[model samples]
Target: MRIAVGEDDVLLREGVTRVLLGAGLDVVASTGDATKLLAMTLAFRPDVVVVDVRMPPHHGDDGLRTAIEVRKRLPATGVVLLTQYCEPEFAIDLIGDRPQGVGYLLKERVGDVDDFAAAVKRVAHGGSALDPEVVTRMLRPRTVPSELADLTDRERSVLACMAEGLSNRGIARALLISEAAVEKHVTATFRKLGLAQLTDGHRRVQAVLRYLAAQGP
Candidate 1:
């Protein structure tokens, strides 16, 4: 995958670039300037952009504004916003109505090379990678939809893993359950959530949207 990076912290920027390069992804451009990052994104149209939540020009949500703009102009290009803090609101804003090709990760996650690289690739390929911590915070203070209230505990856990962009096998591994069981829970979740007619990918994204909606303000 081809990726562009934007971060004001030089060390972190270089580290991320290095990590992407080491993962064998093409680092088409790397910049500390938020404006330059947008310019590069328009110019190169990299498969994905790894951007800090705060950057130059205003140093407060400039990166996020650019990310939202990128999504508007280049919906196919994936965006992953990196932050030092657990800010669920930013994730909600970035996702908006369309949740595909998007990710919101904590900066510390960068240290986990394998997982971070997988997340970037996942988003680039039209999946999502919401930070689990962010999702936890989003779920902490809100109630889910009435439909979701009927989900069994196992079904709810399966839905949570799905929000993390895990495949059925991956979910199975994470939850220590059989893949068949995961599939059954997924089907039940979809039925209960009134998402039985959507395509597989769309069903997953819609289910994720409903799950995240529990955190909406």
Candidate 2:
């Protein structure tokens, strides 16, 4: 898969490029500037972009903003935003209403080369990859009543793993349950969320986002 990287830290940028390249993915462009990153993305139209949440010229949420713009202008290109810390607000803005072809991960995650590569590939192929920590943090603050309140604790745990973009098999591994059990929980969760009609991937995204949106902020 073709990839582009945008990070202000020189060492980290090179490290990310090396990691993706070593993973057998094509590296079409790398840049430290958010604007240039967008320009390069437009020029190359890479399959996925690994962008730091902060970059040159602003060093704030420039990369996150650029990722959003890329989604708007190049809907086919996937984007993964990396942050030094867990930033739930940025993730919310990045995912918006449509969470497909997007990811939000901590910078430390890049050290896990295999998983990081898999995340990029997952997003490139129209799947999501939210960091487990990000998902946990997002879920911890909910006290309001919503559709999520209708789910059982086990179902909630399964949905949390789903929010991390894990497949049923992956969720089974994480939750130490059988794949059949995961399937049952997923089905029940979908039914309770009124998402039984959408396709699998679409419903999962909608389910997670609906819960998050109801939780507020």
Residue pairs with clashing backbones, model 2: none
Candidate no. 1 TM-score: 0.65
Whole-model lDDT, candidate 1?
A: 0.88
Candidate 1, residue 19: how far the Cα is off, in Å: 0.5
Candidate 2 error regions (>4 Å): 143-217
Instruction: Count clashing residue pairs in model 2.
Output: 0
TM-score of each: 0.65, 0.65
Put down candidate 2 lDDT per residue, 69-107, tens digits, no spaces: 999999999999877868676787788888899999898
Question: Which 10 residues in a row give candidate 2 its minimum summed lDDT?
Answer: 172-181
